[model samples]
Target: MEAGDIATWVGVLITLGISVATYVQSRRQARIADEANIASQEQVEAAQRRAVAVEDSLAEALRLLAERGLTEAPPTPAMSGGPGAVRWNLERRGKHSYLLRNVGTATATGVHVDRNRATPIVRNMPENATVRPGESLQFLMAPTFGNPLPGEVWVVWEGQPEAISVPLP
Candidate 1:
């Protein structure tokens, strides 16, 4: 071929090679970005699992502590206005009363107790009682209180941000 024709052909070949290389490079970059996104999602899921594990551990610790004993003295019935400051230990059996105890370090205020069922019946126990750290409160409920159907006590403590459902024996 003539020199001009050869040069034109060479230029066209070079431009086509550069375009193909650029496309390949872009595809490689997109794959890397997708891999990074998948890695980030996996990390987030792992973190969520860890958080759930931590919450479970804390709950178990609290249950163990409550089972052991109360660390502080509880307020009197008159001062407490009656039962409701703490949750009952379903493991404990009593002829006339359920064994209630406080497991938290701080006093639980505005305690509300409810018997769980299809239709929950809130106990008429004192709503503003305070249960001291590690203290037990004998809850004398009426109508011959029986074992909980679900084996759990729903308790709301004052000064606490949220309510806790404690498992019974």
Candidate 2:
């Protein structure tokens, strides 16, 4: 063959090599992207499961507390009130959370609870309640009450203001 033919053959081989390398790189990138997507989805699912667990635990604890008489509902105006039977005025947006004291000199006897059938959540209990007479407790709540249903908390707390707190779950 002529020198030109040999040169053309070499150019063809180089072009083919480049094309194969490009294809391989593209395939590798696609695999990496898929793996990343799967991992991200798994992380989101795990977070959701954790949120459910927290809500369930809260519900169970509240139920147990009620049974054990740890939780005391507010009494009627005539029945009379005690130091431990007072409601911590809550400014809750959603999900049962501990109160940041509004304006009172009362101590936290125990955390409040919301037992809505659709959504049931409970405030964090004091490990060893150290709330001062006028100071607020330092507990935060979930962004929203993830119903064990959804929107059921509003009903239970509404009918009995003395028995239950305001709408939280």
Candidate 3:
């Protein structure tokens, strides 16, 4: 073959290689763009899920506050030390007394009281007791062992999903 013909064939081969390389590069770029788009969509979906969770949490918190306002007592101390003197004592030495007075408008039914975050004690409230408005219930805690720890009261009443917590003095 002639020198000119050989040179022309080499030029054609180089042109074909260049075209192939360009096509491969374009395909890679398209794949990269598709991956980026998928990642962006996943991020958006995650953010939407988080927002929905936050909204649900806020709704539950509002409902709990409303329930407490309707049902929980206003911590009215009953009169102690005979019938004439009006006094309320939560704790006195080894004897611990909790006084729960229902000052809300609604009556609390099936009231149960217990302590929380302390050594396991089997003391519970009276069975099937109901507290009307302006009425009160009393619970006593006497630790047989070590000194009493500052504890909280868990009050469960009827028609309420969560318990009402009262910290004792």
**Which candidate gets the maximum TM-score versus the true structure?**
3
TM-score of 3: 0.40
lDDT string for model 1 (97-128, tens) is 45467654445545656543312322223344
lDDT of 2 by residue, 1-169 (tens): 9999999999999999999999999999999968966775665456446645755775787687788887675433213434343334445544434444424343333233433332333333223232334444433344334434332222111123443333432
Provide the lDDT at 118 for model 1.
11
lDDT of 2 at 127: 31
> What is the C-alpha lDDT profile of model 3 across 93-115, one tens digit per residue?
33554456665555555666544
**Which regions of candidate 1 are displaced past 4 Å?**
71-169
Q: Which candidate leads the pack in lDDT?
A: 3
Q: Model 2, which residues run further than 4 Å from truth?
A: 69-169
Report lDDT per candidate.
0.55, 0.46, 0.56
